[model samples]
Target: MDNYLTKTSETERPEFKIPDFIENMGPEQIHERMMASLPEDIDKMPGGFPFDYTMPTAAIASELVHYHLVRGLMAAFPEYAWGDWLDLHAKQAHLSRKPANKAAGSLTFIGKPGTVIPKGSMFCTAATAAGSSIDFLTDEEVVIEEEGRATAAITAFEAGKKGNVSQGTIVLAVRPISGLTSVTNLEAVTGGAEEETDDALYRRIQMEHSMQSFSYIGNDNDYIRWAKEVPGVGDCIVMPAWNGPGTVKLVLVDQNGEPANEKIIQDVYSHIVSEEDRSKRLLPTACSQLTVTAAAGLSISYICTGLIYDKDTTTLEQAAAEFERAVQQVYSEARESGTLIYNKVRSLITDLPGIVDFETFLINGEEKNIVLSKEEYPVTETVSFR
Candidate 1:
């Protein structure tokens, strides 16, 4: 794979390289291409046998080509060719995908004496909104143990923001129980994360290239990048000297793009402290006032209206619902690891379907480019569409 991209013949185009998409093509299509690979002078010369459309010769040739093509693409492509580009680009910095994690929370069971809530028992929220409700399974057995109540940790089967819910929301068991009376979540569920998506990872790898190595305790870029590289962290902000000289304040939001809670703040604080103690921090600051804090929340509201087209019978209410979905999609996309771009939201609304004209668009009751700090997010507090 080392010289995979090198031309089969040096006398050919010196810069010749395979199309990046070639690696992703299926075998059947590659075989078709091979079967059609007759010489330009083929028609001029008599052939012992014409190209065989129903034979394995073309497929066999394509299989070999496919193997080398894939390895060559992985070795030579700028995106995947780690050693020459990513690793060497940022002083040997390598981009790694943050693995997905399951959502976890505590579930309480109230049952009669000698009752047992075995592990893997399922429970969900009372609300029936699809995609909004979460289902969780207990992590272990919870015997009443002579008491009428017990608590056990539970986790969602899938990793995502859908698993995040407030305390006391999970009040129903998925299946009926002989002795169990009721179920409820004791604490708000958090820490569910999907694997780093291709888009997000590409952005991070590109960002690393722009981040120059720091001398001494690094600046805002250094701190922000370091914090974001953490396994569960999604985004970060650094406030240099927030508490006076040699003091730094850091804010982190979870992978869901929500502000860091006490637990997340403490985790970040502990990580920074350990890294600084070991002098592995980006800039190795001498100050110990490196504090971590959760970001402040800002609620936003939206009121939208658009006229139905002349030929369309879609009600205004239906149009409103459609608009709401479109707008939410915009927020959901960037809610994981980046700030919402106001212009992008506006653009998406303009593109919503069944709208003749946009009547009113508001964010926090104003119309402007609403830029958010790295630690801040635009929350949907209210929406009314007509």
Candidate 2:
């Protein structure tokens, strides 16, 4: 993955600098040039007729020049392009930005036996002190069994990561259902992702150009491209011939870079292979077998001592949370390196908000780097600070 998509400190190219010639076309410069062009005898002084007449013309000319300059930049580079312009570039590459996806999961309802939970029944997460809840609607109707429990498929009313709630957080039903007593999720809701960012889309567009030649064959790049076409897929590790000849395996992660959930895995598989009809697959039949699986998550724990923090600005607990976030970010960026450098992790932690310094830091009780297999990606687990 790192080979194909090198993670850089900056996601976008640098801002385009206007040429000196264009810079000289500003209103003031244009006005001065026009004044100079008039005859020496002409009354071109400030507030005079010639001055007032040329000022507006110069201003309009400068505005036109600025507009055309921006249009030219948009036409010349993807970095300057946005919205519709960016879409045009993607279309030319036969790619489109992945749209946001609603989180889907099963909600278990407890109620009177044989009670019907109708489709479109609404549920929501318990509101926090911030005072808002994420709503979900039932995808299908289900009746409570003799055990007084029933599970129904549900989707978030709105798309995006805000809908990915923790287990047991969804405790409220929007409207009263007489027979439905209570509802909650047994597992964490997953697979919710925001629409692909401009940076992310640009990266994919760049990758598309690099892999165009290998697209015809069932190469690793082709498999990767096909898998990423599915919404919610962030990155993929392609292992060709992992099972033997004509076999390909793709280990995937979601948009947040955590291990892909079952739903995402199945979506990628259906997109590339189309199990119902192999002929409909994007890859050729020459790739006799294909397997799509979620990347295994390797929990990363941290232990630190002699932590230094400013209590005026943040508590130890807040600093620890910041450290955890920094660790996760580093892990996500370096996951493709197949090894998490000990120093890199320690550096990020020491730079956390409210953190001044740390006397000691150990990753999983080791001073050495953590190495992972091809199928594994690092996930933040626990942080112990003293």
Candidate 3:
């Protein structure tokens, strides 16, 4: 039996004539021709190439060639991606010397002529570092104190669910809207102003609601919890955080459209504004505030820790992205405090046992291969089943 095999073409080679354009072309001309042939969107942004034209065009051409080759390989399998095939090929190459499947157990190397044998598996060699794995953050020392406190509050509410289900018990409160906190009565000197007019009351209520609609009172952690416990409480939660007269005195209605608990509503309203002030007390030391204060000084990373709880229907990816965006917005104000700036995001995660790889794809002209890259992120997430 033959120990080695060589590739040979079964069909006879045909003579071909070169066109005038083809014969006269130099490397630059060849590159220009290829570039001209690319899809219009391929070279454009948003819907096009990521890099600029300054990068050597040949490098881009090489990438396209590599892509085409991968597609061609994928097309052969019709069911497997190029990455999958490459992984299988690497494994097969490893097993070839082992005596498990042997009509002949001797080793054979298949590669291009004049090429040196591979030192290590191609897939293994090309594998990235535990670049960005979920596990990378499994041990990340991130403390989501705010989120934890929010969770604890929710948990406490959930546990006492049977005790207090009053819509009044879960009142939504707000601090004065920062921009339009106070409104004055225009009828102060009106001759007929002893009693409030219905029209006047309606106008004030509409103004307060409008102000609330435009203001952000930070993440509405409490409102979300209250809404979950009581049905139709979403409207209650939508009330303005404005400090209007009789606003604090206004009755919080029940599900039947009657005042549920006016005293509790007022207390909740007062507490909301008081709580906002209390939280703001930390502003002197707040990372965001410090970023603003040090605008002419330090190059500091205004880091705040946030945790992603499973309670929300949002995925970890979505939560992480949102948190990252929040951080970026905060960090943008600190840009004058440093150079070479970009927003950095780190997840506060905890725990990993069973290992799973994230899916990665390698697409070739005719074949697409799927592979999993091992997880490796710098941040370790704290783990707790409870």
Candidate 4:
């Protein structure tokens, strides 16, 4: 097997390149080769019967080579394989793609005191412009407090990111409780994530293969892998013995590269250490303690002066929004790098559709790159243009 974990140089690594033989195989080339191999007396002209008959054969042969040879090669490597082929690699590595997770949060119910809200009570968000709403179901029974309000834990009716609703969005009850007055979420409901993608599964498989030689007795890489096994976890930093010997601390972020919320933090902890059962934990038996927390969000503000754009084609607000999106794209991809390049951000802004040029561009009120610590991830706080 190719050692993908090894680097040829400090900054360079090997990548798979298609061989010339495979690259040059096409229907036209195959057909010409077939004609040349035949006797000269045979009719191989474009309008001849021999040409027409051989052309179809060549096309079919080319397709077989592409499917059986080209696709087979791709399926053999975790880096290039996708779909079911990727799953096969994952199985060999003892890894499985994380499935989509349902959003979970508390819902506040207001009504007459002592009103019983039954388990499986349903609530929904307001219908969107398309006349659709996400539904949530109560996880257990609860009663209204003396203050005519109570909070109940709830889970989304469906599994996926669509269940992640903002605060105050769940306003309607599917069936009105006799004494219930209103319902809403006090905090943003989060932790919902889509099914893991091919790229994510590939990374885990690569990590699995790379760490095969390393001891899995609660090492930094082991903790990183354990945290990532949770569905909503994106990436994490593991600090072994940060507090003291036999103690490990983990800082995590969600799939969007944002600081994880409490739900995700709890999920990772449960997966790694399992507070209720020490024996159920993934950690080494000798590891004394583990602590899991969310990464601190470091907000980076942008200030641009003398902004120029095509006013006739788009407004300043539109251009700024586009630039903000571009910044987010770069930030998401660079989260693991631990530094945000100032020039790269400026270049993205300059390359926007209506943007012409900016006399000054600053990140977090400076012209220098923003460096983050292991427990920090950058978030776009604000964008201002003059």
lDDT of 3 by residue, 307-385 (tens): 3355445555554344433333223222223221222222112211111222221121112211211111111122111
List the pairs of residues colliding in candidate 4: none
Predictions ranked by TM-score, top down? 4, 2, 1, 3
On the 0 to 100 scale, the lDDT of residue 312 in model 2 is 82
**Predictions in order: lDDT:** 0.64, 0.80, 0.25, 0.81
Q: Which regions in candidate 4 have their CA more than 4 angstroms from the true location? A: 1-16, 274-280, 301-341, 344-360, 371-374, 381-386
TM-score between candidate 4 and the true structure = 0.81
Candidate 4's displacement at residue 250, Å, is 1.9
Q: Model 1 segments beyond 4 Å from truth?
A: 1-48, 51-75, 78-92, 102-158, 172-188, 212-216, 275-283, 307-344, 351-359, 369-375, 382-386
Error of 4 at 131 (Å): 5.9
Cα lDDT tens digits, model 2, 1-386, are 01112333334545555666677888999999999999999998899999999999998998877776556665566665666777788888889999997787879999999899899999999877986999999989999999999998888899899888889988899999888888999987777899987677777778798886337677777877888888898888888899998888999988765688777888898898787986776867788888888889888888989988877887777777777655655665566688999988888765666778879888888899999888988877788888
Tens digit of per-residue lDDT, candidate 1, span 188-226? 887677776543554565666676433244677667766
* Residue 249, candidate 1: C-alpha displacement in angstroms: 1.2
- TM-score for candidate 1, please give it: 0.59
Worst 10 residues of 4 by lDDT: 4-13
